[model samples]
Every structure is written in C-alpha cells, then in structure tokens.
Target: MAPAARRTRPSPGPGAVGTGPAGEPVHPAEPVPFAARVVGWVLAVGGGIGALAAFVLTVEKINLIADPGYRPTCSINPILSCGSVMTTPQAEVFGFPNPLLGIAGFSVVTTIGVLVLAGARLPRWVWLGLQAGATFGVVFVHWLVYQSLYRIGALCPYCMVVWVVMIAIFWYVTLHNLHHRHLPVPGAAGRGVDALVRLHTVGLTVWFLVIVGLIGEAFWFYWRTLL
Candidate 1:
C-alpha cells in the first residue's frame, strides 16, 4: 500500500489572528491595528511634552522657594500666571508640588507608548493597569482644573498643557481598552463601543470645547477686559 500523503498547512498572513489551521475555530490573535500604533506614538509625544512642562514647573518652584522675590517665566500675565498658581495650597495637594506627580506619571505614559509603538503586545493585566492609571490621572486633572478655575483663581500655562495631554492620554487609553476587549464591559455592547471609538476625534473635540468654554466663563472678567 502507498504511504498516506501528509497534509501541509498554509502559512498565516501578516494580519492573521488565529492559532489553529485557517478554517478551524480559534481565538483571535493579538490586535495590532494602525489606530493602536498611532495612539501609541501620540501618547509618547504628548507624555514627553507633559513631562517637560512638569519639570519646568518643578524647577521654577525650587527657584521660588530659594528666592521669594523670583517670578516664574511662565508668569506672563494675569490670565497666565504660574507664580500665582504655584503659591496656592492646591498646587501642593499632597504637601508636595503637584508637578512631581506629573513628572512620574507622564514618564510612565511615555514609556508605555514607546513600548506599544515598538510592536510589544502588553498583557491584558497591563492594559487594565494602564486604564486605572489613566483614570486616576483624568480625575486628578479635573479636580485641579476646578481648583484653578474656582478656587486658586489663576491658571498655569504649563499646567494647561499637562491637562491637554492628560485628556488625550485618557481618551486614547479608554478607547484602546474597549476596542481590544481589555475592559470588562459586556460583549453585547461591543458594537456600540466600537462606534464610539470610531468617532473618538469628535468626542474629544467636544470634550475640549466644553472645558475651554468653562475656562472662558470662569474668567469672564479677564476675557472681557482683554476684548
């Protein structure tokens, strides 16, 4: 009798997402979409900008402490005054300068972004951890925004930059988790979630516009005077 012929499996394509033979049932392989890569690069650049702003603020804080008469370079005008904001108790919410937190948090964000861009697939747990961190960051930033608007009564230019980057980080991270199934949301909601993710830029734009409106309203007197 003739020997039985062996069956050779076809090679998977670059975007193939399965372990078994092409037709057999198998869980999807890691999702490495273009959106993911774009988000990663954005995170890296935004985080770096945030870190630089934070570092500058920290250095200015030190200089102020060393010489009470020193004014921060960012203290350009009444509406944009880091000196005034830094002196407020809110700036040291944990008895330490708030910029310290920014430096540490943004450094991690930037590192993660770099890793993602390098095509490293992080585990689900790591993605969850990132979600948590991003959540905390967004919450903290909102609180600081409230303080700056209604309590401290001054805005820091660098701090605003941090706010912008933080919003971007949080927005993208949330979308990534949802699209990649890292979030615990029900599978039934996947379609809706995907729709939201697709319109992410629109959502982000509205979010930012709302904040800008709030800022303008909060400092109406300054804006009115300028106009």
Candidate 2:
C-alpha cells in the first residue's frame, strides 16, 4: 500500500475546541453544542424568578384589596413603594392585574426551559413562539419601567426583578433565534446579528447598564439622599 493509503486522518490540535471530528475547523456561524444548555439554564432561572416575583405581587395585590389600609412588605420607602405602583391604573393595563400575565408567561418559559435542559431539541416553530413571547415581555417591561420612573413616581422591587429577568430571557432568546436562523439573516443585518451573537454577554451587560443608568437618573435625588 502507498504511504498515503496507510496514513490515518488528522485529529484536532490540543486546544482546538471548535474543530469538527475530522479536524476541520467548524464554521464560525455554527451554534455551539453547549448553547442549548446555556439557553436552558437562562430560561429556567430567569423564568423561575419572574414567576415567583409575579406570584408575590399578585398575593400582595390581593391582600391590599382586602384591606385598603394594608401596607405591602415591598413598600420599603416612598421611592420604592410597591403599594403606590400597584394602585396605579397602569398596573392593570388590561383591566386585570399585570402580574397575572407575568405568572402565566413566566410559567410557560420555565416549562420550556426544563424541557430543553432535559435534552429535548425543540422545533423551529417552538423557538419562534418563544421569541414572540420574549419580545412581548421585553416591550411590556420597558413600558412599565417608563411608567414607574415618570408617571407612577415609585418602584416595585418585585416588578424590578421581572424586568431584569425579562431582559435576560429576551436577549438570549433573540440571540438563539438569530444563530439558528429562526429569524431572518440578510446582508449587513446578518453580520450585525452574528457579531452580537459572538459577544452576547457584552451586549447583555451593556443593555443592563443602560437600564441602570436610566433608573439612576430617574431617581437620582432619592439615591443622593442615601449617599
């Protein structure tokens, strides 16, 4: 036999984590195998927190209704008063408690996360559905944030938790959709999405920081008192 015929195929170098089985470098565009797990954990943890916060807010609202004089435990200060925000018409945008929606949405998110973590590969339609849900959540949270800062003139700690987790869940879900082509990938937009996907953590950190800045600016006077 010739020397070539006797030669075995090459293997990935010592640190070549991205190489395929035949030692070829995988496409940069290919999703990492571990991404499913990361998405799962994010969904599970974020959804769980959002759900718990929503449930607490629901219970607090109920108690407040039963006793108009009741002060919510989360009503820590004038600036951070859950009761004040709860009483606002904005809290029931659909003529029902906003947290009721959170309870339902976040529960589904948690269930989907558990399924993914258990090694279920969800279909594209399912991913799209999650993307739609996350988009709505992120949008709604922003509206609530705006109302809290400007109109309601108070903050709810539990609602803030929902905001944070909704941001995370939306960011990750968007990244996932882009990577898997569940969303369109065209031209410069595609490249931009690819860049975002590669540096997702940085993007997420910056996103949260912007929100923090907005919160700080909105409540700077109160925060200054503590300083």
lDDT of each: 0.89, 0.91
Tens-place lDDT digits, model 1, residues 1-227: 99999996665555656657456535565656637887898789989999999999999999999999999999989878999999988999999999999999899989999998998888998888988988999999999999999988889999999999999999999988888777777978988888888898899899999999999999999899878
Which digits, one per residue and each the tens of the lDDT, describe model 2 over residues 22-60? 668554454555368889999999999999999999999
- What TM value does model 1 have? 0.85
TM-score of each: 0.85, 0.85
Which ten residues in a row are the worst by lDDT in model 2? 25-34
